[model samples]
Target chain A: MAYSNKARDFFSNELKNINTAGTFKEERYIESPQGANINVEFPVGAKPKEVLNFCANNYLGLSSHPEVIEAAHQGLNERGYGMSSVRFICGTQDIHKELETKLTKFLGTEDTILFPSCMDANAGVFDVVLDKEDAMISDRLVHASIVDGMRLCKAQLYNYKHSNMDHLEEKLKETQNLRLRMIITDGVFSMDGDIAKLDEICDLAEKYDAMVMVDDSHATGFMGKNGRGTHEHCGVIGRIDIITTTLGKALGGASGGCVSGRKEIVDLCRQRARPYLFSNTMPPVIVAAANKVIDLISKTTDRRDKLEKNTKYFRDKMTAAGFDIREGVHPIVPIMLYNAKLAQDMARDLYEEGIYVIGFSFPVVPKGQARIRVQVSAAHEKEHLDKAIAAFTKIGAKYQILGKKKDEIIAQYGY
Target chain B: MSDDLKKLIIDYVKKEYLDDDSEEIDESTQLISSGIVDSFSMVALKTFLEKKFQISIPDEKATTEAFDSVNNMINLLKEFNVA
Candidate 1:
């Protein structure tokens, strides 16, 4: 039987509006692997132009690494491409188990269970661990996946302010009567490029007798001295009870996720998580590629350190050019534009200037908080960073967003 | 309890996510259907309800039907006999 026309009409109308709005962005096909410089193919016989790629999550520049590619090829040849089955149903390969074991060891956890995607990992979490007798306390600014996951749980829920340990403490006191409590948060916020206060959170978790969970999707491979994410960054490596992260971003740019934690918790999630039980296991190529990426990241501080230097250089240069950059060490840098229209206009102008950056506003963020989200990578060279800064300065001056050169502002303020 | 819950939720929204001059929220207005509450906010709302009404909200009951409007949330509370 055909589906109902009512839903189809509504969905089609919405999709059309999205296309009409700049927000309904279609993908710009790339002919190259993700890196600092890549070629995007336009329709027709249009020449594929090289552009500075600034909006990728390839923090370590390992997405197209030769070793990682070789590993993927070897896996494809030896194990075939995919398992048409879920993990528990004859899909558990030795390679999968090896990857899980490596991830657990890397994150300093007792065990880990893999899922097809991080979104599924988050969506499948709450339903498994939480019940009517439980309490789920989460940060107000957590990822969308965490929110969805919590919705599927039968637990009393509470949200403290973003990284506000004091508010978390109060909430803990408020929910002290609940049977059990679980605290969930993002290790690093993706939008604002801010690191979560995990130290304070862990302290509160101990005082309140609650378990802590963090989604380290953004922080996993680029944060901390050893790239162990927020826990390592905050010196609480073994304090967090559960950690979930993705292989889609820094790990390999392929797709996979895992819930890492105490053996019992991981075992329980493996058994009960709807996405883990229902969805097909990750392909062998993806698993192998991710395993290689992790090994590269762990073996040397080279990739993460290079990313840190690039991030600092970009942040300093952009700020020096009189642009309003979000203050942080996180790789994500938001060049604030105040008005939504201005941000959109700036992004368009930058793209025309051969720099690829994404403008976000209103629905994605707050209305007045419009900006272009620039993600710097270790793959980026000095030339690429300098080019981006120059382009921003030119367009920013054209739009009067460049308030003053850093020296001028500081001097004028009588510093 | 109803008045207090209304004030707490609205105040939290104004202080946390929205502008201080946010549009006045009527208890009967739709939150989810009207797009005021996104998927992320839905989980936050569950926590909000649990803290405010002292009731346990099952995953099966935490749907758009229960959180669509103030009236729906109030009705859900009544169904659970938590109000």
Candidate 2:
């Protein structure tokens, strides 16, 4: 009749074990709207401290943009609030349709279908397209959502090495026996901040007759010359088969995702994808605001341009400071601190110095690859970037890891 | 375990997942519990092993525990040999 102590004991022991292992996750609460700088209440109950944020996916700094907020309010006033039903059952508003159409044009895809989140889009996409006779070959370093999505389908699943085009080709060749071969990858590998060679991937897909899918969640808002995601950046527009991306990142930094690609695949998703069919439509305000975001970005690339400039500034300053960083033009800059405990400790120390960043270890990344992933936003001005860079330099020095080799850092920190 | 086969897996795991400074790996290394390879990534390794050895490791024998180390993976491969 009551919850059992036996089950409670198992969880309690597990928690204790995690604590002993120094991997217990502690969440830092943000007390203000997401932007370049925000108030974070760290260590749970401490007074909120304003810190220069460098860990948000607010790439284009539209999370709290005045125009986007005004758009949201205008939609709230005009379109009212929640959509109580699913899309097929009276939840389809004109604004929703408008956003999808605009997104199609913006993403260079023929059609688009909205989902509550990219996770839901991924979770529901695979099963609609693949069956037991087909096969799915994915990049091994793809997002966890893609991994979960692949599990839902009955297709033979294979993972090629991360970003190894030759290995992807090998998997493609191996899976050629199947009825259909689908290649899945992230447009930008989130952890590494590396861009996928979509140009090469598209060539492989063409040679092998495999369909290609890209989840451009990280690079959707501002990646190319025109800020049109990785397809445009890689010169492979109209070559990809299915693209699943998130509005939750740079596109207003709000919520909503979509499956945008050729008309037939999207048509299939609308008819069948479980998440879209069963779940209620996104709120009218989000839909309207997202439409405004698309219109703004379409009109000009100012915000994405600012973001690109900011990313270059931070990466250049940090690299010049002698920190071990993955060299890339992308905004996600990882400062490598090889030991797990060292990553956590450095993040805590950085928080003390008025910078908000998170340490990633183990499951979030791979083992022994602990890092402090700093995400630069268009919201960050010169002062904010300078402050964060200064804090990281101080913390890097305190840890004596500045310009140190990976072996030296591990020797001192001990993973 | 065959030294060459063990080296192949160690090399693959190191290059794919672990950093250059990852602690010394050997036949006794705990790949799963130590967080070097998660279950999903292990699936990639399974594909790699199957491709290299040209043997189909049954789903039941492909548990994370069975693929946790070079020794364990070697043991699992041994089952295919006997069969």
Q: Evaluated with lDDT, which candidate comes out highest?
A: 2
Q: For model 1, what share of native contacts is present?
A: 0.38
lDDT tens digits, residue span A201-227, model 1: 899889999999999999998799999
Across A175-209, the per-residue lDDT of candidate 2 in tens digits comes to 88889889999999999899999999999999999
lDDT (10s digit) by residue, model 1, range B1-83: 77866666666554443333547777776676555665565777776678766788998999887887766777788787865
**Interface Cα RMSD, each model:** 4.1, 3.2
Q: How much is the lDDT of residue A400 in candidate 2?
A: 90
Over the full model, what C-alpha lDDT does candidate 1 score relative to the true structure? Answer: 0.84
- Cα deviation in Å at residue A246, candidate 2? 0.5
Candidate 2's error at A331, in angstroms? 0.4
Provide the TM-score of chain B versus the true chain B for each model in turn: 0.74, 0.88
